[model samples]
Target: MTLSRRPAHRDVPETAPVAGPIRVDPRTKNLTKRLTAGDIAVINHEDLDQVSAQALVACRPSAVVNAAASISGAYPNLGPQILLEAGIPLLDRAGEALMTQVTEGVDGSVVGNEVVVDGVVLAEGTRLDMPTVLEAMEAARGNVSQQISSFARNTMEYVKNEQDLLLDGIDLPELRTPMEGRYALVVVRGYHYKEDLQTLRPFIREAKPVLIGVDGGADALVELGYRPDLIVGDMDSVSDATLVSGAEVVVHAYRDGRAPGLDRVESLGVEDPIVLAATGTSEDVAMLLADGLGCELIVAVGTHATLIEFLDKGRQGMASTFLTRLRVGGKLVDAKGVSLLYRSRISGAALVWLLIAGLLAVVAALAATPGGRTLYQVLAVRWDDFWAFVGGIFG
Candidate 1:
């Protein structure tokens, strides 16, 4: 059965909810890839961020049944709002039993705020509408100052733990690709990444920057027809195909040198993949790696740079990112900002069409005025005479 597009916020009245097949996954990212239109997405994601929410919205799911709290009121997360704005019915905090009771691919119905299967209520939760979401966002915003204070404290504590990142570009793992004095492109799968990459296409073509992908960002780069020169992350989100795709893999380990993701890399038959134990996010590690290798410029795509963006990722601290950016200094450029600043040149066909339009305008003006017509006739005769002389000489 086909489902009609959900009406806008104003149009949607108080009524029974739409029904569809249920697709369940704890991870929002994994669920996004498998979700189809008219399906109900059952996810266990807590405090859903805007990026994941946007991904879920792209799938056009009829409804979302979250096993965990969609918004824990941590810091005004944007995911729930995005989903509600897109007119997707969200039943937040549906409980773990819903995941167990609601079988995948089964005909599930969202009647009001409850998940019903085979005439039985499997789970019931609060239906997140616009007003509720907005109110929550306002409350979350009020708590932001507290979160910021906490974040600052965490950053200071982290500085004490990881001062090496600032003092000396901490020890980096040896890699096959050389990065010294070269341009580097580090991609993280966050915040309008697809659009940013689309805008950076010309830059990518011109500079051919050393492509570095953090975990699933490698898959994103591969999807965009660019092979990653280095893949650095915990290896949880990236696929096996990407691991074997010839990118030099770097497993981001804990400060104590525990490389959990290295086992996955080894299982994939990647030869001599390096492990860099660090006290920061993988994206931070990737930047430090490039900077340590003396990269002249570093372009960051989809990497979180803003305070809210960092908070959206559920980060209580930005110490490593703070230090990494300071160390890289002038070399680091955010792709979103770069895309906004970079103007694309007009295409050849577009320029040709513009020239043709200008000529037509000139011809019309010549036809409109007697003096212009006389001048045009004189120019036509002179142009023909000049071409005739050239033709005679050439022929």
Candidate 2:
């Protein structure tokens, strides 16, 4: 079945009680998944890579089962982690079929962590409701299995550049944790981030922490309400206007100790110190800034977090991402789909207004064109046939 183009749960309350718990088992088929009024089936494959965070939010599932190595390799996405932290139970290392049993048993639980599933006992040792613990375990598994594969494949490629590895200028700065009580907004340019900045207006007016943007995000922040405190990345996505806006600039450099983006900054004659030469992508640098600046919370938006997302960008520098998260640990918050969570509740009048606007636009356009006039004429000729088909259905 096809879903509607618009989000179905747009009117759902931000924090509603999940309907009766659903039962699932990732391993077996004999086990039947339970269905409650609010229960939803979440399959974590690289599906997280294929869909937008907002799309997932629209489903409004009470919990999610992550089948993928969500916390593994060099990828660290802020979306799922944020969901977990927000009290959504995250179950990884479980297949869809097996997890169905777990969801079904959520309502009946006690004695240690064993969740009773269809008279079967699930140990607390395996099931998880906390985000941080689940993420770490998933990462450890991915690292042991995937990291070894990654090392073996890329080992020989760097044989010719042995000396290049010794360069100091290109080394990533030492990681630092964000300070207490301050929040940092890390921005990236993505679909609708510019328009979505309006959503941050409330947060900005209230929390007002350090504002840092990655490349184009700096420009985006400037367009919104707040001035950025720091700008990190290669400086390519950022604008001349943003560069001169007096924010501190940090340029990501090649692992070989080259400052590729420095010349661009100089061409613009930007006077602020551009910390050149760092490892990883710009988003990685933005995270590092939060860690290094001592900000209490790191709120990232429009940033890429999935394997597909990274592949889409054709990234070659995720090494820094893996290491950066290790430094920041648990304080990172990804606000990717916050807008969808707190979207303006569309009222009856507003939807009516939208329908009227759409109809008017179509009518006006049709009236303005001869092709449209011809199409309307054809429709008029077919009106009898159309009504006949409709009448025949009832008859």
> Model 1, which residues run further than 4 Å from truth?
1-13, 345-395
Model 2 scores a TM of 0.42
Residue pairs in collision within model 1: none
Query: Cα lDDT of all candidates, in order?
Result: 0.84, 0.55
Tens digits of lDDT, candidate 1, 76-170: 88899899889898988888766666688999777776677776767767888889888888888888898888878887887787787788876
After superposing all C-alphas onto the true structure, candidate 2 shows an RMSD in angstroms of 20.8
Q: Please give the TM-score that candidate 1 achieves against the real structure.
A: 0.82
Please give, for residues 33-132, the per-residue lDDT of candidate 2 as tens digits.
Answer: 1323344333444323322333334344455545444444444444455445545544444433344334544553222222233344442223344556
lDDT against true structure, model 2: 0.55
Q: Give the candidate number with the greatest lDDT.
A: 1
User: Which candidate has the highest TM-score of all?
Assistant: 1
